[model samples]
Target: MRIILIGFMGVGKTVVGKSLAKNLSIKFIDMDNEIEKRENKIISDIFKESGEEYFRKLENDLLKELVKQDNIIISTGGGIITKQENIDILKQERKVVFLDANVWTIQKNVSKEINKRPLLKQSENIAETIDNLLKKRINKYNDTYNIKIDINDKNINEVVSEILVHIG
Candidate 1:
């Protein structure tokens, strides 16, 4: 089975995904890294050069290709669930886990990397951006995720434990 981790940029998807994959003895793939590798450019660069529309198209295509693999753990991009088609494609044959954290927590965790995120980089206020974006996408995240793990008061290990419990 493919265990897909979905959430905003700062919710520890990549770190948790790596730990979970190791614990489960499966390959772990971060969709954003995969895109950067394939395009030979960082995600921020992709957004700067080609625009988010183009990058989302690449992300959509990659997700379709990735679900064909077996026993993989996927850490999806923050906006992966923004499109209905993408959500439908993932739900076809995958277990999607949403990692939950408030906008304040997200901003705190992602402050160092805010420059790396295309959408947040354009915002005049990062906290406000995170809040607004989360408000807009929370419903979609809830609708698409099969399992939800609230990591607000949890460490990485704790978060992984919760995910394992739910997955099993």
Candidate 2:
């Protein structure tokens, strides 16, 4: 089985994906991490130097490759839905799960790792920024996901278990 987790940043896609992969005894791939590994630079650095267009192209290319593999769980970056080609690719998948969370939940989750995020650095009010982004992306997420999981009140295990139940 191949499962792809998609949502806004700080929605716990990576954490939930890892647990799901572990329980299913499959490999877990964080798309951003994979891109960082391949480029030998962090995502923020990629955005800073090469720019977001470059990063998005790299992401698109990687998505094309990863979808061909089996027995893996892919946790995609938040902005993957921004590109039409990427959205098309995700729509083709059988198990694309959108892990949904509220603005306050997202702010709390991302605060610890704010330094790692490039987009958040562009904003002064994190909550308002997050809300705006969510508004823009929520429709795309709704259209792409086969399963929608509200992750606002769930732990990693709970999220994973819920995914397992749905995907099973």
Candidate 3:
């Protein structure tokens, strides 16, 4: 079985996916890392040099390739759900889990990170941007996911346990 974790930037997809995959004895793949390896460039560089449209196309292609793998836990980028084709491919081939977290939780988590997120870098009002983006993507997330886990105040183990329970 393939499991795909989808959510905003700071929602712990990578952390939780790694733990979950370890526990389940499945291979774990971070889509962003996969993209970086494939393109031989950082995501920020891709956005800066090639633009978001190009990045999105590359993300879509990566998603297609990822869904074809078996017994893998895949953590997707924040903007992956924006494309209907990506959503369709994920829903058709994997157990899609939406890692839901509030704006404050996301902000706190990301604030400590050194890596730059393209969307958050452009925003002066980070909270507002997060809120608006979450609102806009909520329905798409809802439609594509088989399970939605509330990630607020939850540790990686708790989140992984909840996902395993839901998937079973």
TM-score of each: 0.97, 0.98, 0.95
Per-prediction count of colliding residue pairs? 0, 0, 0
Q: Which stretches of candidate 3 lie over 4 Å from their true place?
A: none
Candidate 2, 32-57: lDDT as tens digits: 99999999999999999999999999
Best-performing candidate as measured by TM-score: 2
Deviation of model 2 at 33, angstroms: 0.4
RMSD for all candidates, in order, please.
0.9, 0.6, 1.2
Candidate lDDT scores, in order, read 0.91, 0.95, 0.90
Task: Please rank every candidate by lDDT, starting with the best.
Answer: 2, 1, 3
lDDT score for residue 44 of model 1: 93
Which model, 1 or 3, shows the larger lDDT? Answer: 1
Deviation (Å) of 54 in candidate 1: 0.5
lDDT of 2: 0.95
Candidate 1's TM-score: 0.97
lDDT of model 2, residue 24: 94
Predicted structure 3: lDDT? 0.90
Candidate 2 positional error at 34, Å: 0.4
